[model samples]
Target chain A: MAAETKLFGKLKTAEQEHEDPKEQLMFDPRPREELNRMVMEMMTTTTKKFWLWAIGLGVGVVVLLFGAWGYMISTGMWVTGLRRPIFWGVFIVTFVFWIGISHAGTFVSAILRVFKAEFRRPFTRAAELMTTFGLAAGALYPLIHLGRVWVFYFMIPYPNARWLWVNFRSPLVWDLLAITTYLLSSTIYLYLPLVPDLAMARDRTTGIRHSAYKILALGWRGTEAEWFRLRKAIQIFAFAIIPVMFSVHTIVAWDFAVSQVAGWHSTIFGPYFIIGAILSGVSAVVTILYILRSTLKHMDYFLRPEHFDALGKLILVFSMAWAYFFFNDYLLGWYGGEAAVRQILTLHATGPAAWVWYLMLICNMAVPWLTLWNRKIRRTPWLMFIITLTINVGMFAERYTIVPLTLGHQRTPFDWGVYTPQPVEISIVLGTFCLFTFLYLITSRLIPMVPVWEVQEGQVAHTLRKIGKAEVPTVTELD
Target chain B: MAEVSIAEKWGLVVDQDRCTGCNACVVACSMENNVPFTGEDNVAFGRGTYWIYNKRMWEGEYPRVAPAFQPVMCQQCGSAPCEPVCPTFAAVHSEEEQINLQVYIRCIGTRYCANNCPYHARQFNFQDPDIPEPMNSYLNPDVTVRSKGVMEKCTFCVQRIVGGRQTASAEDRPLRDGEVTPACVAACPSGALVFGDLSDPNSRVSQMAQNERQYKLMDELGTKPKVTYLKGGGRNGG
Candidate 1:
């Protein structure tokens, strides 16, 4: 027995550290009750730093966004750097960029959910919230971009006193309809799935917070019939929202495509925009996931390296898709040899804005392809975050290039002019960014960031199965 | 609101050969239409709100340089790109007069029409324009002074067309051949611009439009502008 003990000690010393499969989120499951408590604790607990950051962001929104916009309203659009030829400047750019960012949430929450992507379970709400906030920020720009924000209702299709009506032929009108539809649908999409979780919070909490959750929960008792209806409704939303998501970006693409602008008037813009949306969306999700994991307590367990690795692969795929569509657009234009198109392409490639174009290529195409091809890099949270962050910057630069750069190019060389955002434009753009972040920060605390029910559902379906000498993670059809 | 049928397809012929680039027509249109005076700072940024302006280009080296000018205004295209893209239909194509109209009150100022305009003819009032002291007294009562954030372009002087049409209608006769000469055409010192009904083939503008040298700017784009330019320095005499 003494010899056996000594031998066991020697074996323990020599044992190789094999990573257990249970370390993965799916393999290592915690009870839903524990997850709810963890999320509630994180939500309820606020450090001084949190309040300071929120207040600072709130001040920024008030001063930069609302204050500047009010000033612009009274002072005039001249305060913006929107001159002739570059009539649509940073406001349009911000509008498009936020729309692109908004695309990420619907894409993940609806598309991934439709496909039954298991890694999507924990982060769908994070993505959906982005859709809501990004769109809220996006919707502001058209109003802000309007020369008279007061008469913004004129864009509404209803007949006016003079019997004048909005032109449905205009892509801008289509953009309005599509974006409004998306905003409404996505908000409902966001809130519908959140009902059960709110109910859980209602039962577990007390006082004002409990009452708030109870009202929000809509009497969700999680009964068999309720669960059945919730699943069916979510399924319907998952299917219906996918096309709406596609249409929203496609309609936005039409805003440019319908125009005769050499760079913008391309048939490929629809799909090209969709591909770009997914790339930016996935990048945003990864970045948000990284932040949640690092900052929130117990989030490390919910968001594992496995999730990062999966998202990295998805981002890589989308990056390749973006490159493909981009090339397709280029090849068609190049082959057609349209003089205006050639001139614009030359300008984009080698002009003063060439740096932006190159950065877009590197960030959206080069970085994702090069680094994401490595499994280790994909699994690294911080590295993936940096990559995604770079992608977002690249996407923003892409929108800027599309709007202002292309607007600079017209058939009349004599009238050709460039745009640079003035202080008002810059301030408003910064304000919108701060506003989106501020709303998101406050929301992340209110709603369960990790969809506990969805996560629990996923955990029920996922199991370990023997494959040869190893135990591999397998997912059964839960529904 | 009754169907007001119009026989005249009004058109313009710019004889570039006769145009010396005096920019008087620009001033005339601005005055006639009550276009606000944009400051020099706005002009430097290319935000000048001139309805009709000379598009000048310099050719050859400094010693041998010659300045060329082409007065560009709203093309009044039959298939106007700007007309269909306006979200508010503010930039509407008037089928009755065959002119492009800018309804200031209807304008929400999305600037989509301005961007769609290949000629860059449209000008947005970036700020409340001030006609310097005493000049405001001469502002045309017939024309509505545009507010800030509204886009204004050469309307082919729609007020003149309305007045001419009213006079013709009262007299119970078809409109005269050159009943409505826009401010720019009337003000041209060199007789470079001609305006008339294209439906009347005998009209001077129609004959000039058929000249071998006559060409439409960006014709390949299919905007099919009603205004035609008689090419200068060609074998065919203007």
Candidate 2:
């Protein structure tokens, strides 16, 4: 009996020395009111520097994006560097890059939510916001790429007096349909989870802010039935939007793949694009999460090191998947013995755009594989930020190589020409980045960046309990 | 009634053996179709709006070097990949003429059709055409000048085909096989280009298309281009 008592006492002591559950956000839960107050402070407490940056971004949008577009329209597409052999240049590349960035939101929010990955709880809103804004940024390019932006209404399917109809057989038409479905569905999905949080914001404010939140909140009293219905709707959206998300990028891939163009005609393009989208998307989410945690006060309490660690692991896994798809795509093209395919692959590796090709490898494959394997490095916020930022640069380079450089070379050597983007294209591309960031910054102030109710629910399901000689962590099925 | 009874499969046969690579056909087509003159600077930058251009390839080396010129233009394929990919119905096939017709006013300038064309035969007017001062007076009245943001290509001079058909109908006679001639065929100094109804089986282009040396460029791509080329030709001079 004395031996048993001593054993129990030793076990208890060992448990005390073990890793503290308090270190985890799930175990160390903050009061919902406290979390709300912290977020509110972050939004309300704006510094002079924030204003300066906001004004700068606003100027960038006005001058660079809109100004360049206006100039292009007034002058001609000649003001841009698009010419023979490379008709689709930087605009197309940026379009695909933005679409890939949008994928991060769906993968993190919808897919993780379906799988019940608890780490997604604190930063799902940040990821979801990316989907909505990134898509908006991406959708702009197709219209901008049009030589007759004024007559873009022709692409829209409407019964007209001229008896004209949009060609549904075109991949661009599929692209229009798929992207619209994704953008609308995702916006609704992003808004569904925000109603309860908006209700929370409404209760804690007054005056103009109060009225704004009041409308956004839809007069939610947080009834049991309201919560029940919200849960059901979110689940339906979560399941439905995943396929839409898949179709959007796949259709984009078809824009290239359906053509008999050498580098583009590949059976592997669908999965290749989806995996690439997730990789770029997850890296973007990780970068944004780190920025939020480092810059925003009291975010340290909600977005703990565990979240970064999980995201880092995801980045690493996706990096491997992207590398696999890339290799599968390249190997077939290299060995297929098609002369045009061989020439394109050769140009991609050793031609004028080879620098971008190599950078894509170093950034997407080398950096993540070497750094993410260490848990400590993944937990380190600044380091993870650099890693993710590198991944984004690499992914952008990959798209550029795929879109422009591949188009530069063709079956006939006579038409082969190199593409160099002019000033108008550069300005618009930079402007889109500023637009995305500006929208995100504004969104952070308007809504709670963290879902407080979800976090509290997560805390409820997680606890540490004693079992034999050890105290192990356990999670109960909350649903 | 006679024109309706005739099934026309319009095609071109380029006799490589007879071509002198003089580039007269290029100028003729450009003038007749009212193609935009983008000038030397734009041409250097790969924005030249030539509807039919010479694709010159140099073979051998040093003293034995030989230059071969192939007059490449819109192939007007039987199974066009560009037709299905145009978001607007700008690129469509004319069953009566057996030719690909590019509707300038309908083209929204997506450029998807241009990208899909393996031959790189399609051209886009990136800017509103400028005929300069003196060249403006020489513009063809029959063909509409293409505007910026619209794709235009060799239509086998559809205006001429229409005019010839009208004349034949007015005269109440069967249209002669050789009555319709594209500007390129008329301008060919070496009599290398033949244009006629391939469906007649007795037309000159049909007989030339059956020659042992006759082959379509990128035939294995299954585009089934109507323009046939007779192999083996060289010009000692550029």
Candidate 3:
């Protein structure tokens, strides 16, 4: 009996040196039903704690968003502290701010998908969810910035007694068109991949959830033709959506770029905004992934270290790219030696909100540079979460600096005024957060937030082979 | 309706040297074409609707840089980028009249056309505008109300062209070259914006386009636009 025990103990010691295949999700396949159940449980298992947070956020959003907005509409824009020189104020800052956040999903899903990045498969849905809801939230700031939300229709090109036709000549108009296209196409792009998961949910769910999934699933079945049609559609959209995504942010930048306004006029603003959007957006995804992997049960197997490692690498690259663009923009303006440009530059770094400008650098450039480079830190879900949160704060500060902060320093000092967003503006922005998280949570239960079929598909394409006495992972060209 | 040859292209030439910045054209374009008045907040953001935006650039410093007003509009380029990129045949360059036409009835608002437009001229209806009580009656019936999710841009006031054509045809005479005037052209008190047929050698626009001072905005982009501007002739920059 002692001999047998020693043999078993010896076996355990050796096995400890190697990872257990059963814990490796790819090596240990669960019954499809079991994985579905876990996802379902996470959805339905909301605690009193959840309700408390939701209600608290909801009340906060209501008071801040709707109430303050109502006040802004009734009283003029003067209520928000916006004046001539600092005309753009917090509203435009928030507009550009949310716009940067909107870039993550497309970069994660489309750009990564185009390159066949494997780790993207599981959390692409989570990222895509950010694209749709994030865009929705981002689009609202322009209208909210409008102050008179009711007469918002006047922006449309509709004909009637009012002789106003939409002037296509303005960048503001382009901002409208580009964002609308992006919001819709991204929504469609997001939904196209989600159909199968919706079908899976449709099969497992009952009552309202079943029908909700059914309608959204578009009567999908996993037949070869269904897959074929779906794949073709996705491929088309995947290629098509990238340019639209790039254009949307570019046009948003053009809202400033294509102007005689000093500091606004630059050829690089198009690519600059595009890169900025992707950088901040990916950081948001990183934060979300970290939260999900840590807070949710059974998410560890789906969200592994390898995924975080891949994301960390991307974050690092994007951080460098952002710094390059930031320096390029700064160098050109500084080199030009234009007096107006100098004033704007001075205001950005030395003004009352100068800390935000500096924090923009430390957070966007410094923090990511400092920590995300380490694989250990990148792979730590909790640490990465804090980093991503900090990145977002830094990015928001960047937008704040660009819009109101820069606006604070204009040609005429007499017209200068500091910007402060109204409580309504604050609330609505909060509501958007509540709305995004609420949608994500609800979707988690209804649809497998992780696209199981895609994961399975990847597994099918991947195999371990004996190459030179080593089990080297190889991928097949099933696609 | 059909692609007109570049040789027969229509365009406008504005003499900025003569412009007084009267803003009459701004109000006129809004009046004739149903352009919406931007609310107080949008004004602060510098996002008011204007088919023709007046740009003022300062040259020197606090005491020296003088603000010079330059009126700008869609340069309806011959190689129109906004035309071919549209997935649906919604935004098309007008071949018959050489004007870019925005078909509100057909546009799906995919906005691909807008992005490709180098001139940065295209607007989308983010929300349906609500005219105040009884203010709805003031809306022009000629223009279509843009539903949500569709692109819109200046058509060089196409409805006016149609109206002008109809009136001319009814008058029992070939349409006079100067008879059909766009709002900006008509309202220019200093005659800064001169609108006429570039196809006719005798017209003022054709002559203006030939001037040494005439230039196009972002000429390097190769839009081959119809709108032309006489070079800045004043102390605003110099």
Candidate 4:
């Protein structure tokens, strides 16, 4: 035993010696009842600050989002900075930005769940919530950016007096179908795993909260049959949602790709947009996780540095992948020898909006490549928050470059013009940001942000085995 | 025996050398189409609603330079880029006249069609027509006044086409060559603009379009534009 101790002591690296296995959420086991109580408390408890923020954001949504939209709808599209040559402005940019953010939830929850990544146990619900809200914010832009917002129903496939079907060939029609499919599938995916937890909340609460949870729980009893069905449903959705998630962004990419616009017409846009969406989405997950950890009650226990570390690695890989596609797009565009495309590419770097291009490259490529490689930086929650935020800012600039910037310069030099976002557009964009945060805040308080049963199930499967003098953490297959 | 006739395919020819850069055609088009005149600020901001405008280009160094004017309107392509991208069938082709049509009431104004137009011919009504006082009195009753949030463009003067066809049908005879002239063609002082039926082999536009110097703008795009331009340098005598 003495020799075994000496050998085990020598086997441990300096980094491993400092790292405690207990710091990992999986290794740190908590009783099922205690875990349930903690999640319930987190949902039920709200501070004065939370109400203040919710009210402020609510007012912002009404005045800035709906109010400005109402004014624009009554007046004209001239309220925005849209004119000829730059027909699509900040509205389309913000639309793509929100859609990119929505990609995070499905990617983290569905993709990681399918792979059975153990670290994804606690924060999958948080990420999944982002998917739904991000979509809610995003799907508004297609209607909001229209010149005739009231007539937006014309795009929907339904019987009309005119009997005119929407042109299925248009990419916008494809976008409508794809986004609708994604939103419905993602919402169902979010609710399926949530059923068991809603039942837990239903049991622990009474009054109005009990009634709400009771309806939402769908009468879950946690019996063996129910568990079997729930697991099977989750497994089926996890696989199904992955492709839906992929197609949503790919169809969005096609909106620009299928156009005859010189810079936007490219085959690389499909995979390029998907990679970009994932990069921005995963970064958003990290940003939200940091916010929840700092703001929510007991979120620190659920969302630890280990999760941040894992997500940081993902952001780094996606950043690299994003850079690859970006370079590939540039190389092909430059090599193709199209004069208009070459001019647009050159204008992007050297034009008046050159700062946006530089910002995109620096934040998306330079910052992540330089910083995320370091283990300490990746593991630091606060630092990850800032890096991920910067990456999102970079992604926004990238979309800005892709949309209005590219549209600003076309084959006709006589018509080339610059576009600036007007005050109304800026207000509307800020309002959507507020709306997303507001939705998340309200949702966090209503639903259990952490799936307690999933975490507890993870804990049941995880145990420390004594091998010689070492206690090695092992996971048994729960499935 | 009654004769069988093919549909009339309308065409236009612009003789650039004779185009004096005068704004008569533009003014006449605006008056005839009931196009709203946006103020100077809006015009300067690239929000002008002109369906036909001259693209002015300067040739040579400052000392040797001369101003050249190319009056660009809708090419009225045989196969237009702006048609299929529209979510609604707002931009469609006229079967009888063989011209592109912008259905004002049908346009939901996504502006996708405007973006797809390589010629930059299509214009959006950013706001309701602001023509005030006596200007509104002369508004053409034949044309539909487009409101804010819809696209409008040169229709090859479809109202005039319909009027001429109606007159001919009532009189019980084939429509005469040079009988149906668009406002811009009728208003051209130097006779630079010609409008006629290209399908009629004996029509003036058909003969003019056979000029060796005549070429369509951006013809490589395969849009098959019906408006042909005779090169501006007086290389071919008028």
Candidate 3 lDDT by residue in tens digits, A353-399: 78888999999989999998876677566777788888888888878
User: What is the C-alpha lDDT profile of model 2 across A280-310, one tens digit per residue?
Assistant: 9999998998888877777877786678889
**Which portions of model 2 miss their true places by more than 4 Å?**
A1-19, A465-477, B1-6, B233-238
Candidate 4's DockQ = 0.75
TM-score of chain A of each: 0.94, 0.94, 0.91, 0.95
Q: Which candidate is the best by lDDT?
A: 4
Model 1: colliding residue pairs = none
Model 1 lDDT per residue over A387-473, tens place: 999999999888888999888877667777788889988999999989998998898788788788988877878987789987666
> DockQ of every model listed?
0.81, 0.77, 0.04, 0.75
lDDT digits (tens) for residues A220-245 of candidate 4: 99899999999999999999999999
For each prediction in turn, the share of the native Cα contacts (below 8 Å between chains A and B) that it retains comes to: 0.79, 0.67, 0.00, 0.64
lDDT (C-alpha, whole model) for all candidates: 0.86, 0.88, 0.71, 0.90
Residue A247, model 1: Cα distance from true site in angstroms = 0.4
Candidate 2 positional error at B179, Å: 0.8
Once fitted onto the true fold, the runs of candidate 3 whose alpha carbons sit more than 4 angstroms away are: A1-28, A159-163, A465-472, B1-238
Give the count of colliding residue pairs in each prediction: 0, 0, 33, 0
Question: Model 4, clash count?
Answer: 0
- Give the Å error, residue A416, model 1: 1.2
Q: Model 2, range B1-238, lDDT digits (tens) per residue?
A: 3556447789999987777789999999998999888989999999998889998887678898877778999999999988988998889999888889999888888888888888888998889998678888999999998888889899999999888888898899977989999999999999889998898888999998999888999998899999999975434222
CA lDDT for candidate 4: 0.90
**How is the predicted docking of candidate 4 categorized under the CAPRI scheme?**
medium
B1-238, model 1: which lDDT tens digit per residue?
2224477688999988788899999899988999887878888988888988888887568897777678998889989889888888898878788888888998988998889888888889888877778888999999998888889889888889888888877777767878788999999999999998898899989998999888998999899899999865635332
> Please, what are the lDDT tens digits per residue for candidate 4 over residues B163-231?
888788777788899999999999999999999999999999999999987999888778899999987
Query: Which 10-residue window of candidate 1 chain B scores lowest in summed lDDT?
Result: B1-10
Q: Rank the candidates by lDDT, best first.
A: 4, 2, 1, 3
